[model samples]
Target: MRLALAALLLIPLPALAGDPLTAAEFEAYAQGKTLTYAMGGQVFGTEQYLPNRRVRWAFTQDVCKEGWWYEEAGLICFAYDGENDPQCWKFWQDGARLKAQFEGDPEGTELTEVEQTTKPLSCPGPDVGV
Candidate 1:
């Protein structure tokens, strides 16, 4: 019984459903849209995709950051205006929605597209006070 259980544990788990989307596919589906994502059943962040690969992202109720995205090593990587290191993700289309996994860790957080709209993101600049 112990050996059987050990073998079961050693067996690799199944990968996430669906193949990762190609760069062109992602571009077509995401461009000109704003998407909100959730992780672990809680709202995580939102992002707006613009032409020329430009993007705007913000944590829930937080300030936004301007950025751009590109494909690298089969992952979609993003570079923000002031951030040095790029954040990379593997994206898969789930019916009308999208699922993303952080490429930095195979078992890292996975985000699900909770909402999408054609409207632009509401990004407020810094130091706005009465």
Candidate 2:
């Protein structure tokens, strides 16, 4: 019985995943915005913002920026300047805050007071039953 209960708890719950965004809406939200990221007080600028609704973030390079991104399977995936060679980082957004964990990094940081040219974007739909 205990094993059965453990198995039940491990079942996939798709609805607990994030909300879906439309392509048009994503473009609008990300077009002029900026994503300021920091790791242990070391700051980096993800200065370009071009977005797709189904995807989370897009764009790249220190120059002309080229990448495609999305949040699925509990991971944030970004494919930049190439195919079959995507980079993924894990993340969670709550209310006005965002947190992410980079690969090989033991700690994650919450992005605070994140300013966008427009209002901040929250995760899609209602809260998951976390």
Candidate 3:
């Protein structure tokens, strides 16, 4: 009986109309897109959605980092550390706007897609010098 239950649990679930997007789906949706969003007034973090819309690299405030983002069940997750106890952020997009509920906060901020570049662009213009 235990084995049967386990088998049942392992069954692949279908993607619902409003269900969370899978990593593969997420990638397809976000890959090859450059998005600009504000984090403070200066605006930081230019995200490049790779083949999976995964955060290939994020640069902001003198920091350059890479990480992965995916959806499970019905929640979207962002992991910055890429290891144990990594900082996680959850959000959802409904075609028009994205609603993000951070891990520690009970509520999230809503953001609209202002602009998306066709490809990943370099941070800190050539004159600024990395």
For each candidate, the alpha-carbon lDDT, in order, equals 0.89, 0.46, 0.55
Error (Å) of candidate 3 at residue 103 is 3.8
Q: For this target, which candidate reaches the highest lDDT against the unseen true structure?
A: 1
lDDT of 3 by residue, 15-103 (tens): 44334455555556567787765543445456666554346445555443556676655455666554454444444455654323455
| Model 3: how far residue 7 lies from native, Å | 35
Over 4 Å off, model 1: 1-17, 127-130
| Superior candidate under TM-score, 1 versus 3 | 1
Q: Write the per-residue lDDT of candidate 1 for residues 1-130, one digit (tens) a residue.
A: 9999999999988545668887898899899999999999999999999999999999999888889999998889999989999999989987778999997685787999999999888877664211
- Relative to the true structure, candidate 2 reaches a TM of 0.46
**Which lDDT tens digits does candidate 2 get at residues 33-56?**
656555456554343454352223
lDDT of 1 at 130: 11
For candidate 3, the lDDT comes to 0.55
Q: Which regions in candidate 2 have their CA more than 4 angstroms from the true location?
A: 1-32, 53-61, 82-84, 103-114, 118-130
Model 1 accuracy (lDDT, Cα): 0.89
Q: Name model 3 segments beyond 4 Å from true.
A: 1-25, 39-44, 52-54, 57-59, 81-84, 87-90, 94-99, 124-130
Instruction: Return model 2's CA RMSD, one decimal.
Output: 11.9
